[model samples]
Target chain A: MWTFLVTEIMFFGGMFMAYIAYRHAYPLAFAAASQKLNIILGAINTTVLICSSMTMAMAVHSAALGKKNLLILFLIATLLLGGVFLGIKGVEYHDKWVHHEVPGPNFEFEGADAQHAALYFSLYFGLTGLHASHMIIGAVILIILIVKASKNQFSAHWYTPVEMFGLYWHFVDIVWIFLFPLLYLIDPRK
Target chain B: MSDHIVPVRVYWSVFITLLVMTVVTTSIAYIDLGPFNLLVAMTIAVFKATLVVLFFMHIKYSTNLTKAIVISGFVFLLVMVFFTMCDLLTRNITAPGR
Candidate 1:
């Protein structure tokens, strides 16, 4: 799990460097570009992921105590929270698509640095796409855990699966921690 | 066995605290701190990440080997990002852009 997170961070680290270079050279453009991202949805997803993180912890907590029912409840909560995050992400992506904000041939920008807006889109898609993939992996893991948990597999002595899954989930949350700033709070003109 | 296995209150408390840190960092990112913006943002991220790894993942109570392995990995990662930034940030990309 630590190795996996290191790779993810390195991946984001590369993009973060690009962000730094571009934002330094063209602060105005990056700022204008940043404002174009949907903060409302970003904030909503933040809340959603927070709820999911809480649920994941509770799931492990219940498992540590060997409470099957609460474990199941928290596991289900984790799954539902994952779905909500993805749903909100979908909405955010749709908004970008509608606005021609996504980097592609059809992209349009009216900002001072419209030509460099592609950089913002690049970072946006690259970071968030990778994050969403992680979220999917986490959801799949919880799905399997849910199946096993429902069958009374986990107990106080053997909750390693839940612990490992928490590691992965928390890593995902940390990715979002950096992502929110790079994507939404760029311009800060408001 | 006893009813208490994990400290539910402490675990949940740390998780929620991480959430709050995320919000606080994001909000602060909107203030335009010149170069400090990214610095502050990443610093806050590191803090939240630390909390999750230490508590949610139980690295604080992990084996010596586990802790060492995790810390070494983080050290290497920091080096990688650091060197990459050194290479990227020192380049001369003109305003109109090279």
Candidate 2:
């Protein structure tokens, strides 16, 4: 699982590379575009994701303790939190769509650096879209774990799946920890 | 069953620390630190990531080989970014007359 996560790290690392390059090239435009994001929504989502990570850690702990009911409960909590995150993300996306902030033909930015600002939106969608998909996948895996857990398939002796999934879920949370500030908090004073 | 079981209180501590850092980073972004804004933000972010990787991900309890693999992944990532920045940051600094 650690090996797999290494691959995942490299995959996301490529996109972060692009983000660094573009933001360096157009700091003003990136900040201008970033200002359009709703920080309140972003911060709330961050809080949700962090809470889910805690639940996920507890789930893994419950599994290690052979506490079946607690494991299932924590798993469900994690799933619900993940659901809240995606739901809020959907709201943000809809807001962007309504305002034509998405990077496409209809995209509009009322700034001198409209073209470069569009680049920021492109990375914004790419990074967050990919991260959201990971959460969706994690949600599905959580469902599977909750089912297996109900069947008493995990215990102190063997709960590798739960631990591994916990790692992935925490990884996704860490990605958001970085993304929140990078995408939403840029030049907030402005 | 040789796996190290982390205490629940440790998880709680890490989780609370993460939450506090989140609030700190968000609030601090509004202060206009000029070039240091990005630096401070990224610094806080890296610290947060390290906490997650160490505590929630159990890298702190894992075997040495596991530790090496994880560290190498990030080291390679930094190498990629460093070399890319080398190219990009130098692209505009051509010879004096060129």
lDDT digits (tens) for residues A1-190 of candidate 1? 6676667667777766676767777777777788777787887787788778878878888888789999999999999999999998998889999999988899899977787877778877887898899899888989999999989889889888887788789778877866776677665646
DockQ of every candidate structure: 0.46, 0.81
Q: What's the distance in Å from true for residue A113, model 2?
A: 0.9
Candidate 2 lDDT by residue in tens digits, A35-68: 8999889989999999999999999999998999
Q: How high is the DockQ of candidate 1?
A: 0.46
The TM-score obtained by model 1 is 0.88
Candidate 2 Cα outliers beyond 4 Å, as residue runs: B95-97
Q: Pick the TM-score winner.
A: 2
RMSD of each: 3.7, 1.3
Where is model 1 chain B poorest over a 10-residue stretch in terms of lDDT? B1-10
Pairs with backbone N, CA or C atoms under 3 Å apart (clashes), candidate 2: none
Query: Worst 10-residue stretch by lDDT in candidate 1 chain A?
Result: A181-190
